[model samples]
Target: MSHRESDRRQFLKKSAATAAAVSVPYFLTGQNAAAADEQKANESNDRPIVGCIGTGSRWHAVGPNAMQLGDVAAVCDVDANHAAGAKKKVTEIQSKKGSDRQVDVYEDYQKILDRKDIEIVTIVTTDHWHSKIAIEAMKAGKDVYCEKPLTLTIDEGKKICQVAKETGRVFQVGTQQRSEMGLRFLQAVALVRNGRIGEVQNIAVAIGGAPACNSIPVVDVPSGLNWEKWLGQAPLVDYRWAKNGNTVNTRCHYEFRWWYEYSGGKLTDWGAHHVDIAQWAIGQSEDGMGPRSIEPIYAKHPVDFKDGMPVQDDRYNTATQFHIKATFGDGVVMDIKDSHQDELGFDNGIMFMGTEGRFLVNRGKIVGAPVDALKENPLPENAIAEIYGGSMPARGNAHMANFFEAVKTRKLPISDVFTHHRALTTCHLSNIAIRLNRSLKWDPQTEQILGDDQANAMQSRDARKGYEVTV
Candidate 1:
């Protein structure tokens, strides 16, 4: 082992020893553990050592949330600045808790995965890197907490599900709307599932459009960044960036979301969150249930496209304006659109219209006829809990804590991979429909596109040599 690995192992050993004496290291030391029995108490008394992969702007939030539940022993990112910033944050968190633990920094995520001391890893990498890193982490015997839109393609989701089942790792996709948001989402789901919204005739999800960016200028790779490594699994391309006042637009970092090469634009960005809830509330998140057909009614991309592939590489290629219709096997029509409906009067939210009543829900509020009627007739006490697999509604950062608790019980978290893959499959199909500018027949049971070979081929991408995702 290298000197850094040697020190990490030694520090972990010492930290484990300290935890044994200072306090019982139950998987949950927070309010969630108040009702545990002695056997449960001893199940995972040693706090799990965690390693954070991809400490970018998103990691600033995810890393701190996870620190509330586990020890962050190490952080890794391709950019030296990100890794250094994450290490500093981890040290500050540990220090505030009265522990003077030193946080190790790494340029390669494989180093974090190779360390046996790390029991959990939070993957906040870009959309394309999520699958490869998560599969490797599970194979290395570590549970994973990965960010949203977990898979870049349909087949990648299948691969992740296969690995998750085979390894029996407790994985949590960071779709916090299921576990947080003041329990409004949970309540909305409960309302729909309990017939509060009647038969659910139609659902409309408005997840705003992607921004059109001017052609970003090709620039020299900045120091402390591994441009080649950062593009793992993605095609080798020139590093591009340009400055506009206080904002820097680039084909790297946060701007990667706007490029189809790295992400699916709003289809997967906000769609990952809103569409997941729409399907969840409609009770179509099961493995063999999903939209039967997706039609791209209207779509406008920033670049020209032929054969569903962007023609130019100098600009953002994802669809900027879209209105897609997803028809489920149950005759439920879900409209995923970019603009707000004047009737609904909200720019971003889910509106379920049903036989008897209707309601609207977003991060801000859950309102409408059915929600308003709750004043006179409230939902059952255990209604939302039942929808959430018996866990009471928890607010703020509970997603990470739920993952740690699952580490002890081996149960799936509120946002498990199975449901997430189903939701993401809908988003992926919608993107494909827009790219092809046509309608698609889907077989949710077989997870295939019916009679469309080219569309079926888009289900998976050939990774660049040396970066293919391995079992």
Candidate 2:
């Protein structure tokens, strides 16, 4: 171990000793503690030790939320600036709570994983890094709270699920829609599942498309940023300056979504939210259940493609315009489009059209003839609560709280990894179809692209050496 690692270990050991007398729960030592003893300690402890990874723009909010449930022991990021900022924020939150706690900052996440005391890890990393880090964390005996769009590809989802099952780790996917205030999404899903929408025929999901841009100019790697480490499992490529050219930052941080090399663009970004809710409402959120076929009716890309692979490496090549249709085995067609300006006449929300009535729901509001009818005769008080696995409605930070609760009780959270993966599979299939500009059959049961070898091969990508995510 390096001097820094040694110092951190000593600090953690000292902190653990101080916690026993200070009435604050510190790290849970994995050494020589029986399962029953660990459970008792977990139940009685005032707080858990949490490590926040990928402290970037999104983590500004996620980090604070995590501090609410546990003491943040460390913050890790590829960017030194992000790690420092997150460490400062963690300290501020701890201090405000009348605790004099110090947070360790590290550029390498492995250090955080190597610590035996970190019982929980929050992964808010970029799209490509989610699965690899999450899997390793679970193997390290740490429960995980991973953000939405859980995996970069369908294969990663399968691997994550397998590891989660084998390890019996509490894994929560950050699809807050499942536990939003007023339980609007839960209520909407209840209405559909309860047959409020009779014989659901179609659903429409409106989300933004990926932006198309010319080749970004290659530039020098900035100070305090590890470009190679940030790339992680992605193929090696030269760092480039931002399009604006004023800042030295590259197409990293929050801007990585526009690149197919790292992400599937809005197809996974926003679709992870909207598509997930769609699957829940339609009763296809579980494993072995998903769309039977995906058709990319129309698509526009920033660069040329051969066999679904972008030819140019410099440009933001993800599709900018797309109208993809996914048909479930039940003959329910889900139309995922860039906007609602098409014939459906909808905007950025989910619309469920059924024989009895139709309803539209988003973060803003839930409306339609079915929902309006509920005004006269509201749903039972327990209706929404029942749909959320017998738990009450979750308001601000309730999703995170749910993960903590599951960590203690060893129960599955509201948004488990299995269902999130099934939903994300639909999103990935849509992107694959759009990239190929063709319709393809899917077998959700086997999690395979049926009879299309090319499409099936796209389910997983070869990871770079040292970053491979093996089961």
Q: Write the per-residue lDDT of candidate 1 for residues 351-406, one digit (tens) a residue.
A: 98998989899999999989989999999986766666665644446677677777
Estimate TM-scores for all models.
Answer: 0.91, 0.89
- The parts of candidate 1 lying over 4 Å away from their true place are 1-45
Q: Write the per-residue lDDT of candidate 2 for residues 160-274, one digit (tens) a residue.
A: 9999999999998988888764577888888886678887889889988776655678888879999999999999999876655543334687778888888998899989999
The 0-to-1 C-alpha lDDT of every candidate, in the order given, reads: 0.85, 0.82
Task: State candidate 2's TM-score.
Answer: 0.89
lDDT of 2 at 15: 31
TM-score of 1: 0.91
List the candidate 2 regions with Cα displacement exceeding 4 Å.
1-45, 243-250, 342-345
